[model samples]
Target: MRIKYSIPIVFFVALVIIEKENNIISRVSDKLALKQTPQTPVQSSRSANTLPKRNVSVTSQGKLSSAFMLMKRRLEDYSDYQPAAAVTTRRKNILLLATTRTGSSFVGEFFNQQGDNMFYLFEPLWHVEKMLTLETGGTNATAAAKAYRDVLQKLFLCDFSLLESFIDPLPVDHVTASLFRRGSSSSLCGEAVCSPFVKGVFERYHCGNRRCGPLNLTMASETCLEKEHRAIKSVRVRQLEMLRPLAEDPRLDVKFIQLVRDPRAVLASRMVAFAAKYKNWKQWATDTDVPIDDDEVKKLKSNCNSIRMSAEMGLRRPEWLRGRYMLVRYEDVARFPMRKAAEMYKFTGIPFTPQVKAWILKSTQASKEAGGIYSTQKNSTEQVEKWRFKLPFKIAQVVQKVCGPTLKLFGYKFVTSEEMLTDKSISLIEDIL
Candidate 1:
């Protein structure tokens, strides 16, 4: 599966020679049925950089080059999703609603790897969180919520003009190199949208790995229109109610999937991933004696309350959320990725492509944390129990005391002591009804 992308090849004449190689993806996609097949990784017949060039008949100015069109043809290898092509090709929006340090990034891969059909954005709200200011209290939060929803709704509809306003050092002529995490999205990285001429990208293993010119929001919008599905993953929006308007929009068909993790694990993870913000938690970690009544703990209490309340709202299935809400636990996905991923796709009413399946197989079994805290690749099974050994018994007890109901609601079990916490033999996840 690890074919070095820099395979020596001559691009003279743009001679197209990709038919054999293109079939590899389709064949691989066909092999991944719902049953637990052998989880062996599939290798490509040739490197992507060497795709044979052909002249595409341009019906409209929107039609891109042979390299890009041929790529779209190859990417249309929806092996597992063929029967649902009509359903899958519809314009659908997905909002991965979650809080930080909750493995939302990892879960996002489930949609991000849907190949060419998916237009995925990672935390577009990061721009809003930075450039906007509001009142210093609850009023500030309400404004921020509406602002986030406004931007997200526009983004879901393939409109980026509004997002440009929030971006500092704004893009000129709708083009800028300043899109936060632009590399995280495939549609933005693809040749058709990455730049006027992006045939060079075919040289890489995937669009995500390709180096593209400055992002032109004009091209991004056009590219998004060509995509069948658009997904945005953000931990910025904490409450389900904040996005009720988006879910109800007549112009958008949106689904909400809320990702939550055990609060003790979330606190343990935040201390490492967001070191600056969690300095107090880190200090408490070293001392192994947390101030259960401290403001920091109270903040944790508020976070737990918000998360639990949000989960309750989704679970309640309010009229606005009928057939549109799904609440997922990070622990369950880490433990059983394939099963959980299938359920997620089912909820979203999309097909699970081979690209996603292959990614999960390769990524979940990683030997090390590749990209540090934000990395999606990890030994997922090991990650599930990692916080148990890291979180001090006393500190964990404090979180348990404060987030007790939250943990119970999410099916996380409490441990009595360090011995019980560190014991890998016992399971800490209770099955939720």
Candidate 2:
């Protein structure tokens, strides 16, 4: 009975061994078949190129392990995929270079009213003049020039923090106060991203309080980097050479708008405004006894020379300017604000939208009704010729003599003695004043 049971068990063990050997052979045969299979060109080359190189040892592993390795390789390839081409967005940087009282304030105000997307700074470099005092020559002037350019570079990059080293809002002078007010209203300091310090000062100042208090309103570098358009209006810079470095920087997309006004008109406007402030021309004149005309004539000559020098530089560097520089006359802008504004927007890469048009119309209308204190708000054809009448016939002749070359270059025609007398009858500057 023991021998019969042992014989049955041996047969059962042999059968189990045979079944196990058969299963091993079947798996080996399947793997060999897969290895020997012909692959299409795409599967053999393209897939191999895209996928990470497989280890021969990994391929020799069991099917489950090999399948998992293939999946992981595919995911790695997908994560590493990058397009050969890319699209990038570049911001527009604009510099408005002009002399003081040349209607730059009005132009800057127009840009400022464009709402959030536009970052407009009015006379940002005025602080340099205030700190260094342009009247002092030598090292102070040299230092101020360098500082001016440095400030411009930082401002263009949207790094307002650099300004704090030189500018302080607590002093409450016109320059400081204006900068503080402008900074407070800037869309760059919107509630979402504004620092606690800026928010506090803004709130306090908005409540009709003049004091700015202790405020740290410098913008983060990233905030400035994200701005769509950045613009600076400067009367402090007299030469284009001062800005050439900024224009040539490959990283910055810079365009320049050179604002020019008739020298006679500018002189007349300056004298009248000065006379009004001091109650007489003597207070502001270099020589108190000198007639207003003589004092203004000397100024006109100096101012015209500076303007001509800048214009001559532009002429010499025509290729450098190309599409980068635009010349806009105050007369043209004043006479046809909407039309000129559209052209300006096009040059600066700013869209001439309905909103901008509406603002222009509203602002120009208000300016006509209520002339501003420092600058005229009136945007009318009559505004241009008002200077002809405001300057006395003798003074106008003197200005034409001193500034004739610049006047001709800018296309400003001289008014005949008869025309000057006729315009003097209808002059509105005195009336408006």
Candidate 3:
């Protein structure tokens, strides 16, 4: 064995043993603990590789001793050498589960307004639904639950490559400019996911304040990965039970926020907001007899049934949920936007950032509704009671009869007549049931 090469190896092994004998690992552990910060994990491997210079003050006769001491110092530097994985950063995954017209868009802003720390997606699953429905001719979540779960799991882990195929199947490279509601995600609109408007290049694709070419999924993925938390809001998932796989996945820490609204109010809002689909219900509002067995009416009942079942499962606190499911009523949120938003952030284990708080303060108190039905900004306090007036007694009665269990379960008071329905002072909602 060459003395020069073999000696360092021997010294390395001896220094490691000495480190163990002297419990240097414990000291390094304590040192690492001191370096920890609230927003960061233990230092990276690069930090481990950072070694201090050693003083080599020894005579030629003691050259071996000098080499041994230098080796000992090097070993001591790496005494508790922990890889970055030793203290990984745990990420928060949030899914805002709701049916259409449940104030999901409005509530979703709580995360969207969280600035750069949050990766918010607004109804990305709508694309998946479109693609799947086109292929299978099935619109129900039951047929598409597994597909939704798989895509969602990947998305929560910051992968959007699979989404490209669903976004534009015709494209050879599998990427599309049309990401559903692409403008809604603040992160996607920022410089990271989108480039600033170039006069001739990307004049068509506008993202609120900026214009960009086809939104690059690669950039969006990078932005998503950089964020400490990811949140997706969708009105597609019919029931919370369908999301068990996501909550139970070891790779993710997921929290489900099920936003429910008074079905009567939801009916009233949907009637005006989605006028075409609710035409039959609108006609029924004029005192026409409601066909309880009609597909639309059955759908209302089905939505109610799905909501109730999910609520029951969530309230049960199953082991899989592990205190991660939150059921929030839209009326409660509209009544107390800040309070509800704060509660949601707490439940999801994220900070209620001041920027989010400020946005809610300005948004809920806007003088006039902006962006019409799809708008996030609104006069929430007044908006909450508007449904009471818009929904006629006949339609309210039908909703009450069909969604009675859901109404009772969610603490919405039932009204008997048109006068009662329109009465300004009557409170249709009671304390959360």
Q: Tell me, by TM-score, which candidate is best.
A: 3
Candidates 1 and 3 compared: the better one by TM-score is 3
Candidate 1 C-alpha RMSD relative to the actual structure = 20.5
TM-scores of the models, in the given order? 0.75, 0.65, 0.77
Model 2, range 289-395, lDDT digits (tens) per residue? 43535544455565675665556445333445545666677877876788877767766667666777787787666645575546435555666677665566665
lDDT of candidate model 2 versus the reference: 0.58
TM-score-best of 2 and 3: 3
lDDT agreement of model 1 with the native:
0.73
lDDT tens string, model 1, 26-89?
4564333212111111111111122222121222222233322222232223123234433455
List pairs with backbone clashes in candidate 1.
16-52, 17-52, 49-202, 49-203
lDDT (tens digit, per residue) of candidate 3 on 354-389: 999999999998878475888888999988899887
Error of 2 at 326 (Å): 0.8
lDDT head-to-head 1 vs 2, winner? 1
Q: Model 3, clash count?
A: 0
TM-score result, candidate 2: 0.65
